[model samples]
Target chain A: MLHEPATPVGKDLAATYKMRLGVLMFLFYSLFYAGFVAINLLNPLLMEVTILPGLNLATVYGFALILVALIEALAYDLFCRRKEQTLNNTQNTQGEGN
Target chain B: MTIIIFLFFVLLVIGLSLYLGKKAKTSSGYYAAGGKIHWGVNGIAFAGDYLSAASFLGICGMIATVGYDGFLYSIGYLAGWIVALFVVAEPLKRLGKYTFTDAIDSKYNSRGIKLAAAISTLVVSVCYLIPQMVGAGVLVEPLLGIPHGWGVVMVGAIVITIVATAGMTSTTYVQFLKGGLLILFSTVLVVAVCVRGLTTQPDQGGNVPYYEYTTLAAVNESGQIKVSDAGWQVVELQDIESAKLTFAKLAKDGKETWWLVSEKDGAVELHETQSVVTTRDGQRLINGAPASQDNQLRQVSNIEKLRGASDASTGSVSPIELLAAVSDKDTQINLWKEAALTDKDGGKVTIYYQKVTPGNQVMRPGLKFKVQGTPLERADFLSLMLALFLGTAALPHILIRYYTVPNPASARKSTIVAIAAIGFFYILTLFMGLGAMINGVLNPADSNMAAPLLARSFGNILFAVISAIAFATVLGTVSGLIVAASGAVAHDLLDRFLNLRMDDHQKVRAGKISAFVIGGLAIVLGILYKGMNVTFLVGLAFAVAASANLPSIVMLLFWKKTTAKGITASIIMGIVSSLVLILLSPDLFKLYGLDPATAPIPLSNPGIVSIPLSFCTLVVVSLLTGEKAKALKLAAQQ
Candidate 1:
């Protein structure tokens, strides 16, 4: 025997989630582009101390770039999820009123 | 003993490969280690796969010889990973099957996308593989004292065997091993550098003496010259006093110790006490005055022979007094003219003294070639930088690694881990390069040998370890590239394009055969392109990947308007444009010094132009053909 599932606000929430994700994705790319330009300008000074044995500023910066990218990607994912939840709650309230 | 250690390392690697090969029973297992690898393990392997021979050897050599500009490559390489993590990693993992083609063709059942992607994969993989093979050849030269061609052959055979036997399963494990060993040993070397401080010594032998030009004249009592217009001559100095001196003195462990020294004038001087007894001029003082015409000037025998007579009364030579004696510019022990060439024939040739000074532009890029009235030759340089920046994410071998992990989360974590490991190793390379430069062990003929030779300075034991690890690093990366190429050939081209209905066993067999064939081709290309930098070849691979595959993948995922025809056109355009541009670029002319006049293209990398073009082609074509595509999709669903 199949059990009936509880009603969940679905299509409206999905649409809002997609829109919010699209906007966050735009911001993510924008931030990375800004960081890239900033780091590119500072590369010369970083290279100066790179002559020392064992410490390389370029490699350190590479690690920093990866860390920043990870944070941006995760934040985008979370923002999309939260926006989807908010839209789902709004759709549920509207359905009850109707 | 070195050979034994090397053999032991090789045996250990082979054993690990066999163990992993046994576990690769299924097609998925063979292709991506059953997609069960931990992010931490895969991440380190990613570091292993990315570092390659270029990061470990070429960067160090470049830094030692070229100075700051060499480190620029390392910066560009690291920055590219940002593009990989932020834009490519999670989405690529979430997309389709074994290859990047799978992802693009998922939305549209388009044969055109598959064909274009497979061809692009082959081109990029072959290009990327060449440098790893070349690195293998370079490593074998010093390790076995064999010819470079033999080294290429050996690496090709080994990588093919590994790829053919187990594919990605073995490839991943090998890369993980290499990544761990590289980081661990490099850290040990760095600690050694910190522990052993720089020092100096007098009477240090075995160093080749440097020669400097000095003019000398012989004068009689009437001031007549004995010889005029002499050329350069080699002279041995009993002692040299400099305000700044960089040299390596031997330490207690037999490793060379590097030092930088500076001394003030009047604090040091060379006091020659030997009196010359020549046939032309009997017994004359030679320490305080310049040599007279008849007085023969000979190099002093020892530091004792250069001791000042006035300082003899003081009994012991103080460091300050020793410095003061050598710093005296007024005292001249000997004066001799350098040798010169004179042509008596109609050719009219004579050796003349001229000062040489390197220009400021020598350190900057674009000095060798320039585009007049433009800032740093925008087209060629920008193309190269763009290729480097975008290429890592697009690379087939790097892309396929994402599939080796379980899910998108693992792919993301692995990339982060890779970034950390790779970043740390690159940091070590800078020090290793500077250390090699000051160690006085850098080979003038080859910059690629800098890291290995630097290790050699510490002892043969360290040298053997580093060289073996380097050899293993090449093997791991090459195996990974071959596996990716083989998968594209067997899975995408043979199965999907040809519509071959084969059992899983047959597919694996075909992939193995393809791996062997591609591995052989990689060897030939590597041998042909010996002495060129490996990093540049990798950049070319990236350019092709970004231009050809990236646009199609991104469009299919995001654009609802994308059509099969649009993707096909985009892939074909991306592949054709980037490859054609690279083949005709000035780099081809400069690398082999081919005539640029005949070259059809001007830019080396097409990413700056071709990437945007591909995206636009997809969009415009999709919009125009959207209704026709809509009907086709509707009918297929029905």
Candidate 2:
């Protein structure tokens, strides 16, 4: 059975993990948010062009959302695996101290 | 065809529920499918339970009426599943016993946590259930010509019986069945669309010219306006009368064919008018206005009328010529109302609609969102978008699905599957909506009828199957919600908080009873909130869920420093604040159309402001109370 190990952090590890996670989350959320804002703002403009044809903002946003979600899921899995590896290494070092 | 298929499918669902009820003898068996369902089946069931009537019906309706904007909802909904898969799924499955409260109280053993979590679950689940019930009512009203209220009651009774008898076992199977049927049939429908191909000419089926009568002053030859005896009706040279036009039949072609009216001395002449008007903006104003209601003048019939010279049956025109012939500028019909003529009863009597050329303003978004003399309504639009994006992740029924799976791995896998299924379905929505728009099956009376009516165009059998699937979609979702609420009441409140110490069998029985009670309440609310958009109601549910449950769950999961007091405070505050904000919002005021002072708040969704507030309260209170609680616990241990 694989068990999660608790590592004693000297503040640095905790801060680093927190900062990395926060940045990643912010980036992921912001990308989607930017898409949303852009579509809502530009939709009306797109409607103004006579030859271009009316575009459905929802369909475009939906496609963007699916793509972003796929990327975010992949990023999250990678982060978790990396974090797990670090935690495992720390546990091994603490066992040597004991 | 619609009635027979709908009844047959509903009966099959009910029969399956009854069978599952008998098998679900234990509490775990009833509440969480004995926590032993296959990941693959549960994944599809997740799709079934998640894709409610709102997704299938409301989205298609929105697209038919509002064009591209309607498809945006599908994107928001599917995106929420990503949050579920990575953030909540695994940890939730690992922590909770049977209910969401179990997860929170497992670490703390606090009565306050149990009570707060239970309350939040009940509130969110109930809010979610109302829309399903409303959708059920809407479906039944059109299918059987019964009142919407009766439909709500019937769905309520059926769902309650299902949940009360079998619990999650029944709910899962029903959702699984529905999920499979929905995907299979919708795919078939999409293929049908590809096969039918896009045609400019109207099919031979009976088609009506889309008409709207606007009232204006009517003038005579001498420029004298003709007035009725009551002085309400005026017959001017160019009189316009606005009449509330109801939809009779869908137009066969994408362009409406009309007999242009030119009146002289109240005598009318009919001229064949056909032309497609394009707005200066990119929007293709079919006849004269926006494709649908948001723009005043655009009208596109389902199929365009084929000219005599271009008739393919006569082998007179090639396919390219057929397309070109219908696309010709002269092939569009534009209708404008003359004037309002009032009768002796003080009511508008004579109304005239004349075919004319459509103008540029028809294709643009009107002044609805714009404030007078102010900048664009960015704030209001942003707030709404935020509410939609965040609300789905916070919904209680969705959150509870994590508990239904056995392990975190399964939960994660299920969420991924759900996202894939939901995403695909959303893609289909574009075609479905466009197909309905061009096929001439859109119900002007209700946009919600788009998908089913679209099916009707193919034949009665397809219509019956589509309608049945739609009804089943409502049933599956409503059952899941009622089950969630019932579990909250029985397991969290009675067993945990009240300290009943009941066996699994007793707990299951209690849950069943609660399901009936809550289901009845949902029916009443659904009937009261009729004629409103289901999608908007769903937004409200998401807002409340995000505000009430999200803070508590997030705090418990990440912040070890969080105390019993902090969790309780946060849950109570989140629920109260969000509910209070929604009740006071502009929607409530506008719904009543009365004094703003009488209403509590000006905003419709509280997620924009209330979600942040809840998170802040949790953080501050946790920091303040954590140390003392830990010290007390250490002292006790010593």
iRMS per model in Å: 14.1, 10.3
CA error at residue B253 for candidate 1, angstroms: 39
- Could you give candidate 1's per-residue lDDT for residues B1-638 as a string of tens digits? 67887888777777788777888777677777777777889999998898888788877777655543455566567666766665666566656557777766766656777787888888888878888888899899879878899999988888887877778888898999999999898877655544432211111122323222232332222422222223311121111232122111112233211111122352321111222112233333232233464433321111111222211222233322322222222211121111111112211111111111121211223222232224435555556566666667778888889888765546666877787777677667755664554344554446688888777767788889999999999999999888889989988888888889667788888888999899889889988999887666666777888787777766676677888888888877777887777777767776766765566676655677787777788888888789876788999999
RMSD after CA superposition, every candidate: 13.7, 10.0
Indicate the residue-level lDDT of B339 in model 1. Answer: 16
lDDT for every model?
A: 0.62, 0.64
lDDT of 2 by residue, B1-638 (tens): 67777889988988998998888898777767777776677878998988898888888877655545566567667766765665566566666656777666667788888888888888888777777877888888867889899998888887877788788988998998999899888877766655565444434133434433333233334634332223332221222333333111112234332223345678433333222333344454423334554543323334332232222222233332333332333333232232233323233222223333211212222222321213325554555566666666567666667666655545656666677677778778867765675555654446777888777667778878988898889989998888888888998889888988888778888998888788878988889878777877777777777777777767777777887788888888888888888787777776675655576665655777777888888888888788777788999999
Question: Highest lDDT: which candidate?
Answer: 2
Q: Model 1 chain B, poorest ten-residue lDDT window?
A: B348-357
* Number of backbone collisions per candidate: 18, 48
